[model samples]
Target: MARLLVTPATGALPVTAGGMTLSLTDPGCITSLAPWRGAGMALSKALRAAHGVDFPDPGRISTSGTTRCLWAGRDQAFLVGPAPDSAALADHAALTDQSDAWAVMRLDGPGARDVLARLTPLDLRAQVFEPGHTARTLLGQMNAVLSRDAANGYEIMVFRSMTATALHELTEAMKSVTAQGGADPSPG
Candidate 1:
């Protein structure tokens, strides 16, 4: 019997495109934190002490030290950083690993939001959806967790199976944005 081994290929992900820098990221950890029954306060506090970030408010993202937390759902958020393997996590909340279940796409540039707007229903205005914002929104029919990493950058997380579709949508949208003069490179 012959068996072929296939490893995840980082090179397969797309690269920078016109007016936008798009790349896939594999975070070291994506741990979900949810209160066990009525331990919301305790779990929130424990996560703060352990990861240095309070449980993010709904539709928000919080970062501290080397860890970043993004709101996942009602009373739940995902911590991306060191794996939640320490003893402290056992006493905090129900923990689950989602690192391998999703693909992280980073889009940053002058027109990152413009590109996203073409694909998602999200209103990517800097005023209402500025940095530190996190929301579960739809991107070209895919359910995605969108987080603003900076004023000109965002992290879009889609199910692993949808990575291809997400990339295609984002790429096409970026092309449209660039064509519309959102990212012209011509010098005056």
Candidate 2:
């Protein structure tokens, strides 16, 4: 089996060559509503009144269908899409360009959550970590935004500077899990 190697700052982690692949990229097309500073109650209310759906609670929102919104922090939320319709959500809160400020790493493998559990405090058990669910938590002591991208994969977001460290930690965890030959506890 191909090993999960840690990449240097400018290097991209291999994403398609092994049991698990990690790809690092600059999501230039994405934008974050992170700067819209306000209380959660106000934002949720505005979103519900405007969009006809309740704004999801923090660590909740699934990324399945078109246009999913997630609470990235107490005062910030992130909208993920081929193109974020900031204007639609802007009517209720503030929007800012976070495309250039963050690095997105896509992690895919049967042991993906095993790698994540070592870094994040959130429970990665199948019963709890399901598709469309998201959580803003710390990964390897650094703030990270995570979402399950598929039944056996995840997408982890962190600041640009912390990317290398996050990858290193994840790689180590995956190795440990593979050595033990344990099945991933996450549900499909």
lDDT (0 to 1) per candidate: 0.79, 0.66
Tell me how far candidate 1 lies from the true structure as C-alpha RMSD in angstroms. Answer: 4.7
Report the C-alpha lDDT of model 2 over 48-77, residue by residue, as the tens digit.
554443456677763434555666776566
Best by TM-score: 1
The TM-scores, one per candidate, come to: 0.87, 0.72
Residue pairs whose backbone atoms clash in candidate 2: 62-132, 63-132, 126-186, 126-187
Q: Which residue runs of candidate 2 sit more than 4 Å off their true CA positions?
A: 1-10, 15-18, 25-28, 34-54, 62-66, 82-91, 182-188
lDDT of 2: 0.66
Q: What is the lDDT of residue 88 in candidate 1?
A: 84
Q: At residue 77, give the lDDT of candidate 1.
A: 87
Best by lDDT: 1
Residue 29 of model 2 has an lDDT of 43
**Total backbone clashes of model 2?**
4
Please give the TM-score that candidate 2 achieves against the real structure. Answer: 0.72
Angstrom error at residue 68, model 1: 0.7
